[model samples]
Target chain A: MLTGQLIAAVTTRGSGASRVIERDLLVTRNNLMVFVSGFVEPVFYLFAIDVGLGRLVGDVTGPDGGPVSYAAFAAPALLAASAMNGAVYESTFGIFFKMRWGKLYDAMLATPLTPTDVALGEIGWSQLRGLAYACAFMTVMVVMGLVASPWAVLAIPAAILMGFAFGAVGMAVATFMRSWVDLDMVNLALLPLFLFSATFYPLDVYPRSLQMLTQLSPLYHGVALIRSLTLGTIGPGLLLHVAFLAAMAVVGGIVASRRLHEQLLP
Target chain B: MVARGLTKRFGELTAVDAIDFDVHTGEVFGFLGPNGAGKTSTMRMIGAVSPLTGGTLQVLDRDPATDGAEIRARLGVVPQENTVDEELSVTDNLYIYGRYFGMPRAQVRRRIPELLEFAQLTDRADDKVTVLSGGMKRRLVIARALINTPSMVLLDEPTTGLDPQARHLVWDRLHELTRQGVTLLLTTHYMDEAEQLCDRLVVMSDATIVAEGSPRELIATYAGREVLEVRFPPGHRYAGWTGLDGIGSRREVLADRVIIYGDDAEQLTSAVTHSGVEVASMLVRRASLEDVFLRLTGRRLIE
Candidate 1:
């Protein structure tokens, strides 16, 4: 029976993970308006700031040798931010509501699924969503003549990695939240990360210590790595960013799964 | 199945005390109790959703502590609270749950329509669960539980919130499952439900089984062959009732009436009236599970 349950857990997680991915990608009738709604918010941000506001800011120096428009400079960062936001949204509020309000996990656990299965499935869905957003955003970047090389393809995987880090960390934090009021703190943490991750400007403008601090931000690594690749500025620094994101994914996954098991099973 | 000295404590509250019992295969067994009687807690342990604080329990000849997942896979459970996912359509709810049991997509596709029909939900298969009424949702939950075709089904207060019609529908489905040789374990506060569905039952109060027998056996042993109820005028008291001591073994004083237990209510009523006990109303009824419950616990069953 134990073996059967474990197998069932694996399959259930796989199906749940797939369902989450499909909910984002598929244009089902019930979700069509919501899908269109998500696009407009980011599109508005892209035009209002990247195009409308960039006219006042002028051109900026790309991390590489080339000079690029401010709009182009900010676009990738917005895309990276969107990736992070999508992942965190799915992992935190969505997961927390399902766990608490919907009692979805409780129902599943009554069957053969375990907390580990749920953690893996939720993270898997977030990563799949992250990759989808990255691909869509990259397509937009390419149409704007901002993507300079095939190297930009790496950003898709980079977005997925960023998703793993954020999703795992977000779910871990969600497990600690006792009510909806605690979600404000989650928003507080996210807003700052969005505004200060050098997503709108180059990090060199800040103090040396501030620059180091920015480098420590997970989004900064995402923005930096994607920024470098889109401009064909590949170097050893790519390896550092990749390693940081990978380590974050591994460590965050471990922490999230452990905490989830403790909370749900114990 | 066996549970020896099973106990569960949540902090300072002992939900289930040291209780011992066993359920044999192929019989309908009931845990009869009132609300807050530790029935749900004991069922949760048996369902393997909650661990036993201290004791030994085995389901299907396997320890639930060590083989919970395995045991759970073969067991069907309908919890007191409806845990159906509201976002999914009724058909999706069953299909997706079957996937949770590792049923092949093809098998689920084949079985989905039949299960929906069996649940009397074929017409609502495409509707989201949020749109369904309470009874429909509860029925959907039962359908979801049956997706894996379990050997044993556990129903905890299955009809607690349903209307009479919906309750009867659920009972019919349960009857079908039992007729197919599925072992059933049910808990309920309804004595009629127990009498109708249970081949055997255990009455629980304060977290322990106080009596166990078939419904009829309990009715005979605990209550008697028959019961006689005599209601006097308002504010009237029993007088000279000691003269009717030879009629039955027990008597109950209720707010509206006085109930006397005896094999012959007609003879008892004649004796009581002849003894100068003025009766405003009189009723004669056979012994029921409710009477057995009242006799054992010294309280009304519905209370």
Candidate 2:
């Protein structure tokens, strides 16, 4: 009987089919259309700056003293931003709404589904969404002649890593949410991370103290790693970026799982 | 199933005081109480969904605190509210819930068709739950509970908010499940529901068991075999009838109705009439679980 129950829980949509079903649900036309629409925002920013600001600023020197357009410089960072936004939307608002208003988690808990199952399943689904956004954005970059080398292949995993980190942290924050009012506080945190983490500018543009502060941000690691790969400027510093993201993923997964256990199981 | 000195405290409120009750296999045990009577709390503890504050509870011969997952696997829970996934179709709800118990797809596929018929949802199997009527949704919940064919089924106020027709449908399904030898435990505010369904019941009031026995046994013990209700004209007080000799016991319900309890309502009504009480209205009826509730709680069960 115990084995029967376990088999049922594992195969139940949460098993494998549900995992695929969940991710498939997130990648529907509306979500894909929204993602494509969001891609236009950053691409428009690139076009506006490269064409509009380019006429004023002229061609800028790459980090390696090569001729580089402003559009090219900001492309990978925007891709990283897209991945972060996707992860945040999925892990925070989507999760919080389901947990609170939708009563989805409540329904799951009534059965044998544990909080651990929810955390794993949600994180897994978020990762899949992250991949879709990363791959789509990367394909666009290639179409726009932004690919610098085979190193860009690494960005796929990097974007997924960024998403994993943000998704886990988002779930952790969602557990502490008391009301819809708290969602604004999440925006307050996410916006600052997006704006000041060197997504559109070089870290060297800031003072040494400010530069060090920006490095502490998870998006900074994501931006540095993806920007280097897309610009064909791989170096030893990329390993540090990978380590930083890996630590975030591990820590975030643990924290989110623990918080979910306390919130749901308690 | 056994609970010894089980208690639950939520913050400063004591929801369930220390109480002991045993549910034997293959019998329907009910917890009958008014709202705030701690029925849900006790059921939650037994279902392995809530932790006990003070005492031991064992379901399927396993302790809930340690064996929650294991015990929960063998139990089916139908909560008071409709917690069925409204987004899913009727058949999908059963299939998914069956999977939650780790049942394989092939087995669930086999069971889903039968469950849909059993719940009488064969025609609506493909319809989303949100579109179903109140009774249909409740039947679907019961059907979901049976997907794994659990050893015990826990229901919390299963028929509340349902119309009489819908309530009877759910009752019929429950009767069928119990007839198949599934141990059933449920809580309800309906006296007739408890009397009709439960083989044994615990009458609870203010977080404690006020009485416990079979429905008829409880009625005989606390309220008697029959009850006589006597009413008089407006402004005519029952002051003269309170300690009347030869009447078994009497209770005034509002200013109009006076209940007289005894073994024989005919004898009691004749004696009251002979005593020249000048009654304006009278009803003699067999003592029901409601009278037993009123006798123990000093109030009507519904109010």
What digit string (tens of lDDT, one per residue) describes model 2 on residues A1-266?
53354356556536633533443353353246765675576667666765687667665556566767677777888888878877887778888887777666666666666765666677777676678667877887788787888989999998988888788777778878888899889888889988999877778889999999998999999998998888788789889999998888777766776677657654
Q: What is the lDDT of candidate 2?
A: 0.80
Docking class of 2: acceptable
Error of 2 at B66 (Å): 2.8
Candidate 2: which pairs clash? A5-B101, A7-B102, A8-B99, A8-B102, A8-B103, A9-B102, A10-A15, A13-A18
DockQ (Cα-based) per candidate? 0.37, 0.30
Can you tell me the CAPRI class of model 1?
Answer: acceptable
TM-score of each: 0.86, 0.86
Which residue pairs clash within candidate 1? A1-B70, A2-B70
At residue B204, candidate 1 shows an lDDT of: 90
Model 2: residue A208 alpha-carbon error in angstroms: 6.5
| Model 1 C-alpha lDDT per residue in residues A214-261, reported as the tens digit of each score | 888999998888888777789998999889888876676666777777
Candidate 1 global lDDT = 0.80
Off-target runs (Cα >4 Å) in candidate 1 are A1-44, A64-67, A204-217, A234-248, B228-248, B252-260, B267-283, B298-301
